[model samples]
Target chain A: MKQAVEELRRQAAGLLKEERVKCVIGWTQGTDVARAVPFFATSVRQAARLTWTPFCVNNLSKYLLNHRYDNTPLAVVVKGCDSRGINRLVQDRQFVRERVVVLGLPCGGMLDREKVLRVVDPGAALQEVEDRGSEYMLRTDKGEYGFEKREALLSKCLECEHNIPVVSDLMIGPQVPSPAGSGIDRFAGVRELETRDPAVRSTFWDRHFARCLRCYACRNVCPACNCKECSFEQAVPGWQQGACWLSKRNHPGQNYLFHLIRMFHVAGRCIDCGECARVCPVNIPLRELYRKVMKDAEELFAMKTPGTDPEEVPLLSTYRTDDPEEFS
Target chain B: MLVSRLLEYVGLEPGRFEMRWISASEGGKVAETVREMTERIRKLGPNRKMRDER
Candidate 1:
């Protein structure tokens, strides 16, 4: 991992000197190993500051979402998951594909926060830690504790097959062989919940929806949610006019409905990066729902979102003369 | 927006399909909207089939 970090720094430094790219984006180790901060390099010196470790888990692609410029191309470092995000943005035509140079990196599943906490200092206080693969050694005054990587992997990482990136103009490291794990049926839980009566499903979601404070963090962080003017905020149509409960927008099921509709809208296009679930303050496993939609898109339509050819039509956009008639 | 764009991507000819904006309160009218769009699109034939081979 340390050697790879140095190699990444070298590549970034060289790219900065190329004069064609305006900036290179990658992750650097946070104050501790538990967090990975996004690093933007405008010069060779700044490239040295970039780093990578097991704790650098956040998807770096969202940084590219707000990136806008009239000139100067951007160079981005992407994992397999992050490349999927780039694909989504390209499909939407939000960014010109020719304007960006991608630096792809092979990924070993990132560490899960809760999993690490459980291992080191189960009840003890772990100030900081780093995953050294064999065991995660943690910083505690008493002494360092270590644990197996399996115990600390994020749910999404547990089943990741594309640890090696799918797309890149330049790739770093030997590509990883496909990941190993029992194939997860991401929709099984959703299906189980759906089997209950509609009333039961409604009851369950009401409790879930009630916890929503409407911070819009999930939407804001989602790469798929990029829109110059979102439908929810359009005043002319007033899609959810007076939608907030505290405000006078008295629309019922407004928040939940907004989320549901948005989910379906991005169904085949969602990359399942887990950003929505990770950033949600309310701890909703929103990725599971999106994953279910992703599974359905694959099984029913043979579509796999932004990972496929970017030119391929979005699933909902092209309807076959003979679409499945289960709903009909 | 998505459907129209998709048909275009697949090199399909323009059709009678219309994109409608329906509100949640107007849910009762959804069936009517779909029926109207279906009739118009069917009259246009399958949009993809109208395209020459890629």
Candidate 2:
């Protein structure tokens, strides 16, 4: 892990000094040991502050949309999941492929902070974490402790589609094997929901969406949501008679409406990176909403996973006459 | 309402929507109408509504 971090810093510095890229987007240690935040490095000297850790959870590809046309080229550090996001934007024609350099960083998996907290004593100050192949050892004020990878891994990482990258300008780190049957049964959660009685399913979703804080973290982190004027975004006071279908109310019905509409908006485009579920404070099974759409698109239209190929047109944007029309 | 909402969500051709009812005794007409609709839709190509969204 240390060797990979050293290589990343050296590469980032080289890119900035040589004018290969205008900026380098990577991860930096967060204020807390349990988190790693996104870092933007514009100069070679600032590159030293860059890092690669098991805690680097953010996708980092969403940052690329803002740099779409800053004139000079930009580079973004990406993990396996994030590369799918880059593919999404490029496929959507959001950004030209030549403008952004992709630095694919290999990731074994990421640990869930909540799981880590459960293993450690309350109020213990976390110090450092050592990544052993099978488990991660955490050093805290209370004492050193080790947790197995499976028990500590984030739900998103357990079913990781790829640990290296399908596409990369530069690749680093060792490959990690994906959990078996995870790819085939990606829609298992959605299928479970399908089996429930209509009333039970209604209650299930109602119970979850009722807790939403309307924070918009899920939409903001979503790579598929590239709208310049989102329907859910708050409008400027009185300038227009629109901009929010969600009506500012925090009613449970309104919350359910907001989530359902947002999910439908990104139906065909969602790459299933699971960033929305990761960032949600209320732990909504938001991925299941999009996954249902993804599953239907695959089965009904015979659509493959989005962003896996750059040339294929998006499913919703293009359709075949032979498309299955169950409702029709 | 749900069908229109779906069409708007995907930003597909709104008027491309089609519905026709044939009496239960007229299975041949239903099959013939479906074949004609398929040909027309295939030639129209993909929806332009998706590209022109606000």
Candidate 3:
């Protein structure tokens, strides 16, 4: 992993020195050892700051939307999950493949900071992280700590389908085997919810939605949510002919409507990056809601996961004559 | 069809929501569908899930 970091920095610096891209988006050391925050490298000196670690979990493809109108080319570092976001943007026509360089990283898995803290000292500065196949050796100023991947990995990483980037202009490191097993069922969570009574499911979702702050962090971080003007952010006056679909009140009903509408809007388009659930402050199992839609789409239309192929047509956007007519 | 499934997933009564296709010439069918839907909805009572309390 250290060699990959050095190579990543070198490549980022070379790209910037050659003037191939106006900016390179990657990750850097965060305020704490347990975190890594997004970094933009606009110069060779800044490019050298790029680092790769298990904490580099953010999907950086959503940042391309900022340069959507600008013609300047950009380079972004992507993990397996983040790479799917690239396909999502290109397929949605929100970005051009020709204008950007994708640097792919084959990820084993990302660590859950909370889980890591349970084993390592919270205040210890993370000096280095070495991947040891099934476990990670963390060298900190305090001491060296070993974290088993199975116990320390984020919940999403446990069932990751793509350990290698789906799309990339360059591969950053040698391909690492996927952490998820072939027998892992991606829809297991959705199936569990389905088996529950409708009343129980309703109560469960209601409890989660009631804690929503409507901060829009999930929407902003999502690559599929690339609309220029979101319906939730419409500023129509109260007396206007075109009224807003939802009121600004923080009522439970409004929250329910907001979540349901969001889930519907991204039904077939969501790439299952799991950013929505990760960014939620209230810990909503948003992935379960989205996966339910994906599961149904598979059962009904035999559609593959979204963003797996850029050329494939979106599921809901097209219809077939043989489409199920059970509802009608 | 997707919307119906989504509504059901959120605990809404499946009978409260229905989707049907009727041509303009099928006025009789449209009326019958509406009557049937209204009866089912009435039996299911008011929707308390997403209704605002204003």
Candidate 4:
């Protein structure tokens, strides 16, 4: 793991020194041991601050959208899931592919923040994380600790479909084989809710959404959620009286509307990177909602997961003449 | 669950929402689902869960 970090820093420094990129976006140990915040290294010297550890859970690909208009190229560090998001952005014509340099990282799962917070000392700064075959060794300023992979890894990582980026301009580490994942259905979380009665499901969702502060972390973190003028931002140019459906009121209906519209908008486009769920402060199982649409698109439309193949037509854009019409 | 919520939010009754399950081997499961949905609709009668937006 330390070798990977050193290589990444060296590569980032060279990119900055050569003027190949204006900035290198990666993760740095945050204020505490449990957190890994996005770090932007704009100079060769600043590259040394970059680190890639098991705590690097962010889909940094979304930040590239911020640099889309900049003249200088921006190099981004992306894990397997984050690279898929980059594919979505490129395929959507959000920005030209050549404008950004992709530095891929071979991921070996990641630790959940909440779980780490419970065990670590207050104000402890993370020093290093050693990836053992089936466990992780967390070395903090306080002390070194070990955690079994099954108990520590994020749910998204536990059923990770890809450990290496499908596309990469440069790789920081050698390709690592994904761990054996059995009985971990991506849609199993949704299936558990589907078994309940529809009203019961409604109640279940409402209970969760009611806790929403509408901070929009889920919206902002989503790589598929780039829009010039979001409909939720204000009254739109066209609509029923031009009022946005989303209201400032903290009503349960408003919460559902906000989340439901987001889910629908990203229906065919979401890469299932799990960033939305990860960033949500209120702990909504947002991936489950999007995965339901993903499941439906697969089963009903015979569509592949979005962003996996940029050449393929989007699921909603292309249609078969004999496509399922029973829903209509 | 999400789709049904979207519909109901806009004043459409969730009971109007539908989903299909296909299996040539499981006619009974299909019939039971339909029967259960029908019963729920009957008991609930008409849905007036719409907000008084006006």
Candidate order by lDDT, decreasing, is 3, 4, 2, 1
lDDT of 2 by residue, A65-122 (tens): 7866666698999988788888889887778888888988877778887787677665
Docking class of 3: medium
* Quality of model 2 by C-alpha lDDT: 0.75
Superposed model 2: Cα runs more than 4 Å off: A120-133, A137-144, A179-184, A234-246, B1-54
Q: Across residues A5-109, which tens digit of lDDT does each residue of candidate 1 receive?
A: 777889888888886687888887565335678889989999898876656666766777667546568888887777888788888877788888888877766
Off by over 4 Å in 1: A118-145, A177-180, A195-200, A237-252, B1-54
Question: TM-score of the candidate numbered 3?
Answer: 0.97
DockQ of each: 0.03, 0.05, 0.62, 0.10
Q: Which lDDT tens digits does candidate 3 get at residues A1-328? A: 8888999999999999999999999999888878899999999999988999999989999999999988989999999889989999998888799999999999989999998877776778888888888888889998998888888898789889888999999999777778786688889888988889998998998898888898888889999899998888876666234466776578778888988888878888899999999999889888988888999998988878888888878887898998988755
| Model 4 C-alpha lDDT per residue in residues B1-54, reported as the tens digit of each score | 445543543334467677766588989888887897898788867654323231
In angstroms, how far off is A23's CA in candidate 1? 1.3
Q: Pick the candidate with the highest DockQ.
A: 3
Best by TM-score: 3
> Which pairs of residues collide in candidate 2?
none
TM-score, candidate 4, is 0.86
Real A-B contacts recovered, model 4:
0.05
Candidates' chain B TM-scores in the order shown: 0.49, 0.52, 0.88, 0.57
TM-score of chain A of each: 0.84, 0.89, 0.97, 0.94
